[model samples]
Target: MVRELLLAHGNGGEETWTIIKDLFLKYLDDPILSKLEDAAVVPLEGHIAVTTDAFTVSPIFFRGGDIGKLAVCGTVNDLAAMGARPMYMTVSFILEEGMSLEDLETVVRSMGDTARSLGVRVVAGDTKVVPKGTADGVFIVSTGIGRVVYPGLSSHNVRDGDIIIVTGTIGDHGACILAAREGLDFETHLESDCAPLWDMVEALLKEGVEIHAMRDPTRGGLSAVLHEWARASGVSFVVDEQSVPVREEVRGLCEFLGLEPYHLACEGRMVLAVAEESAERVLEILRQHPLGTNAAVIGRAQKGKPQVLLRTAYGTHRFLEPPMGELLPRIC
Candidate 1:
C-alpha cells in the first residue's frame, strides 16, 4: 500500500485500480455500484429530486466534520429540503499529488459511514490527481438523487402569514470554518454543524406538519434563504432579532470579527415557512428531534415588497441586507 498519493494513481493503470479496490470499494460497497459500469441504474417512483454540490473547504479537516462528510451531507440536505428521501449519490474526487493516503482513507470511510447511516447509496465515482500546487489538498463533489415524499415544498410557496422557523442555533458552520482557517483561539470552542437532515424532515412529514417552503441555510446562512424566498415569492419576513438562536461562542466570534451571524452559514440547521395555524405544532414536532433542540419561531412572512425586516431588541426594524460580494472563501 502507498503512504502517499501519486499522479500515477489517477492514470487508470495498476495504481488507479489498486486505490479504487482497496480504499473506495472497501468502505463504500454498494450492490448497484459493485457493477462498476459507467452509469448506475436504480429503481425509483414518484417525483425525484436531484442536486449536486462540491466541497472545497479551506481546511480539509475541521472541528466537527471533514470535507467528505460535508460533501455527502450538503448534497443530501439539498435533496431533503425539496421534501425528498435521499436514495443514491455519486462522488468524484480531485486529489493533489503527495496527499496522505491515510487522510484519503479517513475521508472515504467517513463518506461511507455517513451515506450508510442516511440509507444513501454511493453508486459511482471518479478520481483525478493534480500537481501538488495545482489544487487544494482534496476536493469532493457529490450528486444526490432522492424520491420526493412531501410535494409542493418550494421557495415560491411562502404565504403572507407563514411562520418562519429555524431548526437550531445558527452560524456555527461559517464561524467554525473561519476560526479553523484563521487559527483563532477562544475560551469556548466552536464546531461546524454539518449534518444530514433527512430524518428531521421525515419526522415533520410523519406528523403532518404543513411545510410551505424549506431551506437549509448554508453558504449565506439564514439570510440567504430568506432573501431568496422573499425574492421568489414577493413576500417579506419580519424576523425578531432576539428570537434568532446563536451559540455564545459563535456570537462572540462574529462580534469580534465584525460579522453578522445571520449572514454566516449553518450546515446542520434548516429554515422553513409553515402555516400560521401549524406553527406551534410544527415547533413541537421539530423540538422532538435530537437535531432540533434549539428550534424556534424567528419570524413570519408579511405582505410587502420582497425584503427581510429585522426587528432589533431595541424595538426598531431595519431592512436586512443580503450578503454582498464574497463574504468568505471556501467555507462550505
Candidate 2:
C-alpha cells in the first residue's frame, strides 16, 4: 500500500504519490513547495536549489556501482546539472521485510561515503519496511538541496549556432547494466559511468566558457535529452555520428543486440551547449578532468526543423527520434 504512494526509483514516473484531501497535511500544499526553497525554512540561510530522485535499478547492484551510490549520485548530479553547488540530501528507504540487515548496512555505508566524497551531508531521512512481495529488493528516494551559484543558467538559454559537447563516452551505464543483468559474454567489461559533476562544472566556469545549456543523460539517454533541448530552445541540432564518443565494446554490444547507442542510457555523462568560440575552452577544461578525458564536440545547433538530425559516417543524414518506450528500462 505504501509503495503505491511513493515515487518510483527511476525517471519513468512509475510510482505516484497519494493525495488524501481529508487528511491533507498543511506542509503538502502548493504554498509549501511553491516557496521554491531547498528545504523547509526550519533554520537555513540564503537561496538553494532542491531536487528529488528515486532509484530502483533491477538487480539492485551492477558492475561499477550499486543502487546506493546511484541514488545519491543521481540526485547530486541533477543539482549540478542545474549549475548549483550541492550541499544537503534527505534519504528515504523502502526495504522489503526479508532483506538482510548486513546488506542494508552496506548500502547505507556506500551512500554515506558517496555523500561525503561530494562534500555534502545527509541531514535527514526516513525508512519504511514493507512485505516481501510488495516491493523490489529495496528502493531509495533522495531529495537534494544545493546552493545556486551560477546565475542565468538553463537549457532554455540554448541558441542556434551553439556548439554541443559531451563529456566522456555514452551508453556505458546502460550497456553495463544490461551486460551484467543478462550475463552476456564480451571481449571487454563495461562499467557504470556514475559520479558527481560539481568539480568539472566549477572548473569549466573558471575558463569563462558561456554555457548555454547542460544536462546529464540518464534514463532516456542522449537521444531523449537532445530532442528535449531541440524542442525547448526552438532550434535544430546536427550530430555527427562519427564524432560522438562511444567505446568499441559498447558499440559492438549494441550492434550485436540491435540497439542504438545514442538511445542508450548514460549516468555519468553530460551534454553542454556553448558559443562556437567558447567550445574549445570548454573542451580543454573538460579534458583536464578525469571524468571528461574523453569529452568531445559531437554536434552543433542549427536553424532548421527544430529536430535532431544525425549525420552518419557515410555522409548520410537521418532524423533521431525518442525511443518508442523503455529500450533499456530502469537503468539509472
Candidate 3:
C-alpha cells in the first residue's frame, strides 16, 4: 500500500508525517531543543539556535516562490523568530521519480539564490528518489543553524501589556496559494509574499528592544500561533480587527469562501510581542524592511482568560479560535 500510494501524485491522505511522537525526537530533548520548536536552541557555550523544517506544499511551484525558495525562507524565518542570526544551513531533498530534472534544477537554483540573499550558506544536503506518483513532485527538509543574538529570550518571555505586532499584511500567502491552485481571478496581481525575515528581526533586536515573544505565522496562521502563545503563557490576547492587515482582494476571497483570513496560513508574516515602550521602535524597524512595510501594532496581551478576542470594527467583539481543520489542504 505504501509503495502504491507513493506512485500517485495526490494519494488518499497517506503522505503526512504525523508520526511526530517517534523515537528520534525522544533522544534529542533538553539542551538540544528536543522540545520540537521550529528551531532547536543549540547552546554552543555561546548562544546559538538550530532549527529544521520540512516543506510539502502541494504544487511545489507557486506564484511567488517555488519549493526551493520556501525551503530556505522557511528555515531562516524559524531562526528569526528565536531572535537569532542565521549563519548556515543544510538542505535535503526527497524527489519523486518522473519529476523533470529541469524542474528540479530550477528549484535548486532558487534555493541558492535565496540563501545568498540572506547571506547564509547551504553547507550540506542529501537526496532520495521515490517512485513517481508515490511522493509529491518534490519534498524538501531543511535544517538551519544560527547564533542567538538575544541571550535572555524565549517565547515564554511574553507578558501582559506587551504589544503585539505583525510583520505585514496577513493572508497574502494563503490567498496566493488559493488563487494559483483554483485558477481564481483577482484584480491585483496577487503573489505569495515569501521571503527571509532575519534581517528585519536583527534590525529590531539591534535597537535594544525588549521582545517578549515571536513566531512566524505559518501553518495555523495568526490565531493558531497566538492561541499557542496564550496557552503557553496563560494570558489572554485582544486583537483589534481593524488593526490586523488583510488586503481587500484577500478579504473578498475569504468572504466568498466563508473562510477567515486570520485562520488562513501565512508564509511571510511574523507575530511579535514587544515591550510597550519599544513597540513603536520595533514597528519602525519593521516598516523599514520591504517585506514589513505594512507592519502594525495590532493588540496587546492582557490578564484574563487565556483566549483570543477580536474587536470588530463595528464595536462587536468575537473570539478568534484556532482553526478547526484544514482550511486549504496541502496548502504548505
Question: Tens-digit lDDT track for model 1 on 1-332?
Answer: 56999999999889889898999999999987878888988888889999998899888888889898888899999998999999999999999999999999999999999999998999999999998999988999999999998999999999999999999999999999899877884445999999999999899988887889999999989999999999999999999999999999999999999999999989899999999999999899889999999999999999999999999999999989998897998998
TM-score of 2: 0.86
Give all candidates' CA lDDT scores.
Answer: 0.93, 0.78, 0.78
Q: Candidate 1 or 2, higher TM-score?
A: 1
Candidate 1 ranges with C-alpha deviation above 4 Å = 185-187
Give the best candidate by TM-score: 1
Q: Write the per-residue lDDT of candidate 3 for residues 18-103, one digit (tens) a residue.
A: 21122112211132223444444333446778899988887788888988898888899999899888887776678786676567
Better of 1 and 2 by lDDT: 1
Quick one: best lDDT, which candidate?
A: 1
TM-score of model number 1: 0.98
Per residue, candidate 2 scores C-alpha lDDT tens digits across 1-332 of: 33222323222222212221211112222333334344544345666789998888876777777888898888988888888888877777787766765566567767777877887767665556677688877889999998877766777778989999999999999888888777873446888898878888888876677888889999878998888888888888999999999998899889989899898888888999889989998999899999999999999998867789999999999999877765776676
Query: Which residue runs does candidate 3 get wrong by more than 4 Å?
Result: 1-45, 185-188
In candidate 2, residue 145 scores what lDDT? 90
> Please, what is the TM-score per model?
0.98, 0.86, 0.85
Give lDDT: candidate 3, residue 90. 73
